[model samples]
Structures are given as structure tokens and as C-alpha cells.
Target: MIDFKVLSDYAATFTHSENDLLRQMEEKAAEIYIPIMQPSAMAFLQQLIRWRSARKILELGTAIGYSSIRMALAAGNDTTIVSVERDEAMIEEATQNIEALNLQERIQIVAGDATDDLSEVASAAPYDLILIDAAKVQYEHLFEKCSGLLADQGIIVTDNVFFHGLVCDIDAVQKKQLHRLVKKVDAFNHFLSEREDFDTIFLTVGDGMAVSTKRSCAEGER
Candidate 1:
């Protein structure tokens, strides 16, 4: 079943010591009013990257570089993460944070609208792991791009499919843009499940995630 919810409050007293660098960045994100990937979500992603021994990773959103850095730390040596962000403000801040961590060589920060021109950015045919967490309305297109760029047994993980529980109750969020985006996300969630080429599992973590892996050639290309 698709579910969303994480244990513990994001801002707790002693949990600040898990990763000092990460904690510092999260605090800074808060100070600057930047949204970040949830801790539970981060942990899940890190575990996946470790298991896959992912060398090449792609991220659609790089807000303050929290997730990208955490993934880098999780994978240790020789891991490359390319994160894309459209906002100049976030890019400037994320650049500073990444440089401060001395991860310039390991991580390549791409500045552009993720939906617009990713095809020209990286010529690599396949990435081992792809993480999606950005504009909700663009996920359908992102999924198409991700599917084209994924390698054998590659996995796709999307965050915020639950959309703060707004997917089920569109009226909860009256903002025109957000409400429409919620509808698109809901449709994508449904589409992922119906695809015979993938086996999707939705785990209960921060904001909900849809984890989809392409069926092997044995599955006969559903």
C-alpha cells in the first residue's frame, strides 16, 4: 500500500547530532526558508544507494544540497551525484554549501529547469539511481526522461507523492497552482501502479515515496 508518515518530529532536541554537517545544512535551510528532503526519506535513499553501490546518481531537485550531500556521504568514495535546480537563489546557496563541504569534484551542480533541457546536459545513457523531488506537475515528464536514462535494474524513487495528504483531498489546498499540481501527482501515482513493466511499492516515510523498478527482460517488456 502507498503510505506517507515518518517517526519523530523534524525538529527534535538531541537528533541534531546524527550528521553534524547535515544538521547544520538543515538548520541553515530552515533559517533561509528552504525546503529539504525529510530525514526518514534521506535515510531510505541512502540505504538504496549503498545497496546499489551507485556511482552515478541523478537528482531533479537540489535544495540547499542537503540530499545530494547526504547521498554523497552515504556512498563514500568515487560516487558522483548530479543535481539540477532551476532557482538561482537555491543554486547559489547550494553551491556555497557544497563547496564548503569540499564536494566540488564529486558533485556536479546543474543549473536549469530540469524539465527543459536535461537531454543535452548529460550524454550518459543510463544512471543507476534517479531521485525525484521537485515540481509535482512535471513528474509525468520527468518519469519519461528518467525511464529513458535508467540503466539495467535501475530504480526510480519519487518523494511527496502524498502531497501533504492533498492528493486524496484536493480541496484541502485551495491554492490554484498547488491544487492542480496535486492532481497531476495523483495521476502519476496511479500510472506508476498500472504499468506492467514495473513493480512499485509505496513506503511510509516522509511525505510518501513511490519506488519503482523496471522489470527485467525476463518480464517481457510490460
Candidate 2:
């Protein structure tokens, strides 16, 4: 197999350069050790939004609203995003970032645990696209909640499915906590692959991404 890291780096050279605001956000996220989406993966995500013309997007995790902002910008001016984050600090920063871009109307940050009841999120049912980039251990739980909120033929994209390639070699992980997290991520991959209601594909995009499209009832029945 080709060296993916090298290939990804080379491919990123062709993607559009980050603007001043995005560049600043990238720098700040790096300085603070905030885990934002890789540029390559983010490019793929933006393309998905453009391809689907996604108008309503729900992001399970909003670290600093980086991905949410990117999606809104690509999905068109009419697009709206509802992002959930439990961390108070992160939510504050993300809100500031969204406001800085004058995207307050396009992106709304909901303060709460994604795994818990989000009545506000539920009220805005049937999102066209849902991005899951939350805690690895709770991926399945998040998926369950997102499934019901997804519109017919909607897509759910899960990030960090590979867990830094550790899922491929769990035995190599010495830390028990990390090992358990990797195992859970691996199990979620299996669970998602076997889902009856959606057709899923795993991509080698940055840190690995899993894109699943809801199958129509007729297709599921068949």
C-alpha cells in the first residue's frame, strides 16, 4: 500500500489555501491542542456538503466551530448548522469563532452532552447531514440518536474511526485506557458496517472517516 500520510500531504498541496481567519483559527487550535479536523478530511467533508447541497447540518462535536463554519460556507448561504458540545469552555470559544465570522445565524451551538437528551436538537428533526466527531467510546450511542434525527436519504459522517491507526493494531497500544478506547472504536466500526438501515463506506481520509447514507425503506426491505 502507498504511504497514506505522504499521499495525503501531497494531495493537500492542491486544496485551496486557508484564509486569514481560518489560518488564525488553525494556529489557535494548534497552540491550545484543540483537535480540529485535518485539512484533507475537512476538504472531503466540504465536498460532501456541496455534493448533497446540505441545508441542515448537525455536528455532534463543536470544538471551535471550525468544521461547522467550513460546512456552512460550502453548503451555501442558506445552510444552517446546529452543533452540540458539552464543554463549557469549548462552547464559548466556538460561539466566539462563529460570531467572528458573522455566521451566528447560520450556526447555533447547543450546550449539552450529545449522548444525553438534547430536546432543542430533537425539535429540529430530520437533518440532511450529521457529522459525528465526539467521544470515541460513545460513538454508537451518538449514532443511535443521530439516526432518528436524520432525514430520508440523509448522510452521517463519523470522524476518527481509525483512532490514529491504532484500531489496526490494538495489541501495539500499551496504555489500558487507550486500548479500551481503541477497542470501542473498532467495535463501533463493526456495528456501523452491519447496520440494516444504512449503507456505509470507510474512507482513508485524515484519521479515517466513515460515511453512511440512510437506506430507503424499500431498499432496506429488499
Candidate 3:
């Protein structure tokens, strides 16, 4: 396996720098030890948004509004993002961040357990894109819920599928006590990849991202 730290640094050299505000936000997140998406993952998401022209997005985790803001900015001003965060502190911070960015109208932070709050998110159904970055152990459940909420051509992007590389190396000490979580993530990856109704691609970028696009009936038949 490649040293992702080095690869991420090398990729940063080719990507544009974050704006001062975003940079500051990232610095704050790091200071507080909040796990936010890596720069490479953010870049990939921006490009994906542009490519898909996604207008309605649902984010399972709103960690200080980093990915949510990035997606809204990339999808244009009219896009709407419903982000769920179970942590009250994160919800408050994310709401403030979105409001400070003047994106309050574009992003809504829902505070509650994802499993319980997802039903509310589904009310805005047929989301063009769904991003999952919350609890690694609950990924399969989230994916199952997303299937009914996603648009026909919608895409689901799941982060941390690699689980710090433990999913690929179950015996690795990195997953010592969390072996069960690693196993579940690995199984979820297999489930997503083998799903007949979705075309999935697992990328090595940013701790592994599983991008799955639901297959239409016609496309699945062929």
C-alpha cells in the first residue's frame, strides 16, 4: 500500500489552496481534533458535484460544515443540502459556520441520531447525491436508508470505508479492539460493490471512498 500521507501531500501540490476562511476553519477543526474530510476528498467531491450537477444533497455527517459548504459551493447557489449531525456541539458549530458563510439558506443542519433523523431527510427525497461520513459501524444501515431516498440516477458517496486501512488488514493492530467495526465496514463495502441495482467504484483516495450510482432498470437489464 502507498503511504497515503505522502500521496496526499503530493496531490496537494497539484491542487489549489483553500481560501483563507476555509483554511481557518480547517485549522480550527484540527485544533479541536474534529475529524473533517481530507483536502483530496474535498476536491474529489467538488468535481463530482460539478460533473453530476447535483442540486439536492444529503450529508450524513456535518463535521463543522466543511464538506457541506464545499458541496454547496460546487453545486452552485441554488443547491440545497440537508446535513445530519448527532452531536449538539457539531450542529451548533456547523450552523454557525454555514451562517457565517452566508449559506444558511443553502444548508440545513439537522441535529439528532442519523437513524432517527434520516426519516426527516427523506421527506425531501430523491436527493441527487447522498454523502455518508458518520458512524463507520452504521454505514450499512445508512446505505439501506439512502436507497429509498436517492433519485433514480442519484449517487451515494461513502467515506472511511477503509477504516484507517484496517478493513483491508483485519489483523492489523490498528484495529485491535475495533475488529468488529472493521469487519462490518469491510462487509458493507462488499455489499455495496455486489448490489445489482447499483454500480459501485471504490477509490483509494481519502481513506477510501465508495461511490455508487443507482442503476436504472433499463441500464441494469443491459
Candidate 4:
């Protein structure tokens, strides 16, 4: 069996080292124990943006704006990113980080519950790409909401679907609350797998990422 840790470490060696500002944000995120996309997964996301030429992007979580900034950079100057965050502290920090890079015009931070009415988000409909990395329990809800706003052939990328490997062994999760959360994550994965409208592929990169794209009518018929 392949050692995932070793594989991840090896993959890290191939990824570009983050620039100084991103490095500082990463350090701060680590020191404060904030959840951000793993470097390998982040690199994969950037690659997707470049390959797809995704100009309009939507992110469910704006944790310090790390991933948003990364996506903006990868998508080039033509990209516009709308990132939503409920936490005031996270929004403030993310705004500062985005401004530090003078990316205010490129990235917009929306403040509110992502699972709630996303009328503002819908206004920018038909996004070229959508990224979900918010609450684990609300993954399904978020997915359902974001699907409506995705472009015809656009992709939806979800992070932390594995929930630190806990979803792989729900019974082994000692804490009751954590076990419940793990079960929810596991259910969401199954839900994604069973969806008929989209073709979802699971990758074991960075906890786990589920990349889903809308299926064409002929593909759906198959």
C-alpha cells in the first residue's frame, strides 16, 4: 500500500514554494490553527484554473483569503473571485491580506452565512468554477446551492471531504460529536457519488478533494 504521508511529502517537493506574502499568511494560519487548503491540493486547484481558464470563481470559505488569492493569481488578471465568510475575524483578516496584495478589485469578500440565501452570489451566476471549503456539516447544503450558479461545463471542487481521514473510519472516531460530523462527511461523499447531474471524481490529495462537473445530456443518458 502507498503511504499517503510519504506521497504527500514527495508531492510537496514538486510544488512551487509560496511567495513571501503567502508564506506569511501560511505561517499565521499555522500559528492560529486555522484550516486552509493543503499546499498540494492548492496547487492542483491552480492547475485546474489554468487548464479551464476559469475567469469567474466562487469560494464558499474565505479563511484569511489564502485560497482566493492563490486562485486569483493562477487565473491571471482576467479572473474575478467572490469569497464568502461568516466569521468576522476571518473576513477582516482576509480583507487585509487581499488588500496587502492590492487585489481588492479582483476578489470580493461577501459576509454572511453561505448556506443561507445567496442572492448576492446568484447575481454573479454561471461561475466558471466553484470551490467549497466551509463547514463540514453543511457540505451537502452548500453543494446544492452552488450547483445552480455553476456554468454549463464548469467544475465544482470541494475540500476536506475526508475530514482528516476520520470519514474512512467513522466508528473509530472516539468523540461523539466528531463521530457525528464524520458520518455527515461520509454521507456527503456518498451523495456526491450518487448525483446524476454531475460526474464526480474523488482524489486523495490533501485530506480529500471531490471534483465534479455537470454532465451533458448524452452523458447523462449513458
Report lDDT (Cα) of residue 112, candidate 3: 79
Tens digits of per-residue lDDT, candidate 1, 94-137, equal: 89888888988878888899887675446754788889988888
Ordered by TM-score, highest first, the candidates read 2, 4, 3, 1
Candidate 1: C-alpha lDDT = 0.80
Off by over 4 Å in 4: 1-3
Candidate 3 pairs with clashing backbones = none
TM-score winner between 1 and 4, please give it: 4
Candidate 3 per-residue C-alpha lDDT over 4-47 given as tens digits, one digit per residue, 9 for 90 to 100:
66786677556553466688887787697888887787789889
lDDT of 2 by residue, 64-116 (tens): 88999899889888987999999998999898888888999999899999998
Cα miss at 80, model 2 (Å)?
A: 1.4
Candidate RMSDs in Å, in order, are 3.2, 1.3, 1.7, 1.5
TM-score of 2: 0.96
lDDT of candidate 2 vs native?
0.91
**lDDT for residue 1 in candidate 4, whole number 0-100:** 82
Task: Kindly give the stretch of ten consecutive residues in candidate 3 with the minimal lDDT sum.
Answer: 12-21
Q: Give the winner by TM-score.
A: 2
Winner on TM-score (1 vs 2): 2
